[model samples]
Target: MSPAGAQPIRAKSRHHRLQEHVLETTTSASLLSTSYLATSPIAQQILARDLAECSDDDEDEVKFDSEDDGDDNDDSEEDFSTTLHGGAAAHLISRPSGTIYGTLRPIIASQVQGSPAVNERDLAQSRREERSLLRDNHILPPKHRRPFRESALRQLYRRIFSTKVHESGCDSDVGKALESSPLLQHDYLSEDASGPPSPSPSETDVLWDCATVASSNILKTTWQREAKTLAQYSGPLILTFLLHYSVQITSIFTVGRIGRKELGAVSLAAMTSNVTCYCVIQGLSTCLDTLAAQAFGSGHKKLVGLQLQRLTYMLWLLLIPIATLWWFAGRILANIIPDQDTAALAGLYLRVLILGTPGVAAFESGKRFVQAQGLFHATTYVLIIGATLNVLANWFFVFKLEFGFLGAACAVVFTQNLLPFLLFLYVRFIDGMECWNGLTRKAFTNWGQMIRLALPGMIMVLAQYFAFEVLTLAASRFGSADLAAQSILVTCTSTTFNIPFPLSIAASTRVANLIGAKLTDAARTSAKVALFAGCLVGLFNMTLLSSLRFQLPYLFTRDDEVAAIVSRVLPICAAMQLCDSAAAISHGLLRGIGRQRIGSYTNLCSYYLVALPISFATGWVLGWKLEGLWFGVTIGLCV
Candidate 1:
């Protein structure tokens, strides 16, 4: 059977391994059965390419010769031996017996070995199944997702303030927006962290949980509870501010009766000292608001007292520079006041005023410290006594003994000193001393942190007040008639402003507490409610001021000319009152969250950059007089 130049026949077949336990079909025709990855898609692709290239080969007829082939209907044995290897490689033995051979592989061989027609539907179905299996096994492809820590602080605030208990939550988103704010965010407060201890069930705000409160009775109960809680803190707080402002009003009232010159001089002096020293002190004191409120809210009772003491120490140290400014107010008075006599008297007044600078720091620190711990009533009690005593002293010294302007200054200084003395006694003897650890060395230790907080606070509060003093100074340049009218208007507006200022304090304190206690949702709700209430109160004040514009001036003096001047400026004052109220509350909110820097920038832009230029342009350039000055104030507030 040998012949010269004979070609050797070649045999080829594909091997496909499969997972034996698979319940469904796969792309590779069977589940791969191997410890390693049994199906290399790359190998399958190469084999497919080879098979396609060889498929066109001819002289490969595969037919079996059966013995019983006489009848056309007789069955013949089928050959399962030949496998097309890329249509190029096929082996057939040239045996003398006329036999053929091929490999019988599982799915691959059965699919294409002898079949002339391929069903694409079955092939596609197999491919889909294989892909699905690969996905289930998670081979090669990795998924991407955002980190949960991004909004950690926001979620944390919500959980802390919410009365509703949650199994798991992300609460940091709300605070995430402010996380980058240096003044508000603490180093320890991680956006994705669990901050201070969450408020206890009893401390949690029930109003916040009223989303599920279906019945009328339940809603009523919740409102009553929240209202009572708010009143307990805000009532005495409001009264305290009212009484304190009454002290200043008493000084003005006593000074006003002496002479118009004295009234204007004292008013200018008060404005000067306030802007240069007192206002800045008050702003710096807010650091206590942030620290003590949270410390108390989180049940860190001792920390509140320590922070209070720290603020006290910090303020006294700051008073040195402030007192120096007050010392030179008389010389600086010429910068604003055109009258030589008034400026000279104002100088004497500033010299006398600087004596009370330390007292101002002490008084403000004590008030904020006590109030932060929820001892609202204590503040009211102390302030009422101080205010009453100041009025009595003012009457005796000014009218009874004729000490005049000096009497007014002395009485105010005494009253300011009285505030801190009373608070110290109360803290030493009263029920609210739970948080006071009694002035420790720790107060002096963490001063750097306190200074950092105080600077922004001072700037925030300073911007508006400094601008107001400048406005008063601008009024002084308008002569005694304008100054006296401005004096009356300023005093009256400030005294009446007590309404919204207390609400602002309540808002800030409540927010700080809720935040520290981890009552995040409650903090947000409280802020919204406080702002709404402040707007309502402000509108009411604006209406009252507008209605009494012409009539209210007689309370201070019988001077028809001054009263007429006040009437002309009343509209501007009325408008200013509305913006002022809102701004005051916003200040409180900012202080609560330790965001004083933002408030500072807001005030700086509103007052100096926006309001001041317009006021000067209108008052001097356009000759609108005192009305222009007041209008500028309103503009600042609106801004």
Candidate 2:
């Protein structure tokens, strides 16, 4: 018999007769457990042919056993209840690939010496008897519906093995088995055996988990199982971040072209005005990223949309303080800066950028909301459109209209504000929005419960990004030439750093989704896949940037000294890219698992308590110039 479940035929005439008889009996059987109509007249012949082959194999096995060893061949009677053991494969799924099922025979499992040599006839008979007994008794087959649970199926397999061993021809087989009950107990009994005395539940669970993981998709290649999940989210995630960060970079470039003063003001505004607002609101919205993903996975469809609505409201209120802070940014900067012009312009630009504060909060919150629902491509599409138009708006307002710094800030406001509206429209109209209900007062509630997660997530994002900007501040003391070079390098590395941003989002969403769906094995597999993918992407970025270190500086600056400094520092940044990517993805994994606070606490200690001190000490005390600052930063990233 072939392992694909086709047994060799011993008698062609009897096989034909048995096939017709089994088909007649199966056709007349009623659907029991599941709902379905009778099979069509056209499919009856094909069904009969498959069932007939199954019965032929069964009868042959019965006859072969009867002839070879003298056990009850059990041939003539048709007991339909026999199929319950393994016959559902024939009556259930109709596969186009022509794969057969329920053809499993009792495997000859005994290894004891002195046992009779099993011949082809015995193997054939064993397989045939299992199949025939499954289909023969006229005890009404189950309907085409839900399959058996893993525990029950595992028990069935155990029974099949036990039965096959006992059926062998050796007289001492039972005695040999009973003498080794300890070994049998190890395999069959749970560790914490109950009052009835059985195997431990832990051992049973382990067996079932292995079996369940093994049985997912028969057609999916073993190598493809883990990778397929990574593929689903990684590509869209990369594209989304690419489009997203482009909007910010374009804003920087458009205003940078205006003048050095305008550039400085916008940079300060980003640090002071936008960063706080953007990071805080976005971080808080990740509360939904974790919650909504689990909710969707757990089958609470409405909860996902409601969570989205709730986050939108929460962020709407969260942005009020952020906007007010930006309003006073210029005044705040004036106290610290020796140059009043730079400080006042910084304040003015922030107020302008604040024009889009609600937009940033809304869009970022909406992004997390839809992303949790696995609607990644929608975010990508909106970002692409917003990014394209943002460049044009920046060019038109800053260069064409001579709006100066305000022109750059206005473009940011318009682009960011538009994203949330566009994403909202998509959810309302698209297929995945089955969870979205119109807004309500319920969204305004859930303050304390949601804040528990939101607070840690907000701190995690702020601590990491804020630590990075500190490196920039530390570079400023090295003189204007070093500062400009550091700025270009930071921009380049930031863009390069975005390669892993998607992976983080994907990891976060995928992990939560799997956990909510009650698939812990799949969730663990996803984490492993995400980690491996992060490594690959990090290595690729490190190699690419390192190779382009000399030439890439020209893309960012025309100044020889600035470009030269960038070229020198580029390698350090490249090496750190790998670590940075891993850190980012790790952050996402933590968020996905609803453990953002651990990462938050870690970053606080690593960046402030460790990394910053190292940078300050190395850059100033050791006088290693810009390299010292980054080296210190890299050391912190390692931690």
Candidate 3:
């Protein structure tokens, strides 16, 4: 209880504090080292040795603490030195206590609290190594996948749901090592699990900032990649759509050369056919987009053929009633239309078109069949051969053979039937036959689900097609000149639309792929690029229409009155191109994200509620006519 006793107690207290500090520092440093070292066999051995040394030092301290109280004050420093120099921990902390806390303290401090540059470099290197290993093992991060060409619908479902299986050996030693190591599991292999705990506010801010920078870099690099991808997908689609639509356009061109009345009649007939037959067939065929793709994606490859057969059978059955309507179309047209000659001619065109109805049905269903299997180029090839034959047939039948207006109808019927025949040949011999499982009674059985999906799709197509057709029908009331002009306008606008429409499809596919891969930022960037491309396309179309307004109409009609009316109205249609392209791309983006219902609703409301009514008001009531009709469409697109 005297000064000598107090002095020993003070020295013991100091020694105790030093021991505590060393223990705390060593434990923290070991944990930090373990994080980086766990993947390496050599580092793991060193960690084990260090851990064992720490345990021995703890035992030595316990033994020292339990020693007799009278003999320890002079021996305290020697004991401390002995503890510090005895094992791997002592070697790690080689400096004497008097000079510094020992070498391990400074190294640990430098790692934890020194320059961020060194830490960042090490962290970056660690990440690079991890990524390299993942790549070597064919283990992609959940947010990324190797790009490949696949069906858009398939990509959408597969990517979004993470249903795609990689062919890599996930049972490899690297994978096993990754799975066993807690640190590696936490960092790389656990993303698909419940994920890490939510970061704190400050941590979240830092993460967000880092993500923003990363996203910016990704955008810069991926923009060209996405654009190139879209181009590859869209190019053939554009040609296919144009060539298919040109079947109708050729009819208009050939018949228009006959006279104003014939031009007007063909326009009316085409509109009627689109509304009653083509659009309905197209809409119904949309079921295959989901059905065939799903069946193929689910590995039910035969079901794709079954779906096509089912839809085709349904369409053929539906064609019976449609054929009846077409047979009586002349009489039906005479009752509603004021121009009897135009009506009768249109009716004649429809009657001839009825011959092509079965072909139309076959081709529409067949397209989805091939497309679901990522055979988009198949349709393009068919259309190329078919479209060339169509142009030649129209020229032969209408002019060379001098079958006149009737020859135009004949040409259309031949081309219509020829398209399916060509597509069938492609399927039978070239490709897409893998899906076909021979005609089965199964096609007759599964009509209900197809009908349900078909009806909505049909309605979606009907809504858009019907609106334009209605405008054409309305133009009939103005006179043959206006009707002919309307036909030219419709043909031109529809043709121009093919550019952006195909681009939209490509964009939708890309965006859906990214979204399915769980790359939200990448998807967003792709959408932006698509929209920008749409804008450029819109601008190009606008410029073309505006500049070539006068020249373009003459291609469809020889009638000066029709051409004059078309030239006057073409600029208004041109102005609508920008809005049209933007809307198409926006819808594609929405579809990519599985929000297509929103697009469908918007399209219905915008056309029915905003566009059609305004068109009627301005064109009919306000007497703005064709220009007013298009003005309403422009406004609706903006909405």
Whole-model lDDT values for every prediction: 0.55, 0.55, 0.63
**Per-residue lDDT over 256-350 for candidate 3, one digit per residue giving the tens place of the 0 to 100 score:** 88899999999889888888988788767766665654344323356577678888999999999999999999898788778999999999989
Q: Pick the candidate with the highest TM-score.
A: 3
Ranked by TM-score from best down, the candidates are 3, 2, 1
Candidates ranked by lDDT, best first? 3, 1, 2
lDDT tens per residue, model 1, 1-639: 101221111111111111111112211221111100112222222222322333443122212132334745322111111111111111110000100010000000000011111123333432432222112122101122225665878677644553331323323332233334333313323333343333222111111121112111111112222333445556665676677678778887777766778878887887877767776776677566555543342233455676677677777887787678767777777765689778878778787776777777777777666655545456667776888899898988777888878888888877878777887888889856776666566566646656765676666556546666777888888988788888898877776677776666566655554443333455576677777777888889889888998888877766788889998888788887777777777876775676645776677777778888989988999999888887776787788
Give the runs in model 1 whose Cα sits over 4 Å from its true position: 1-234, 290-314, 317-325, 434-446, 504-536, 579-603
Worst 10 residues of 1 by lDDT: 98-107
TM-score of every model? 0.59, 0.60, 0.66
Q: Where is the poorest 10-residue window by lDDT in model 2?
A: 98-107
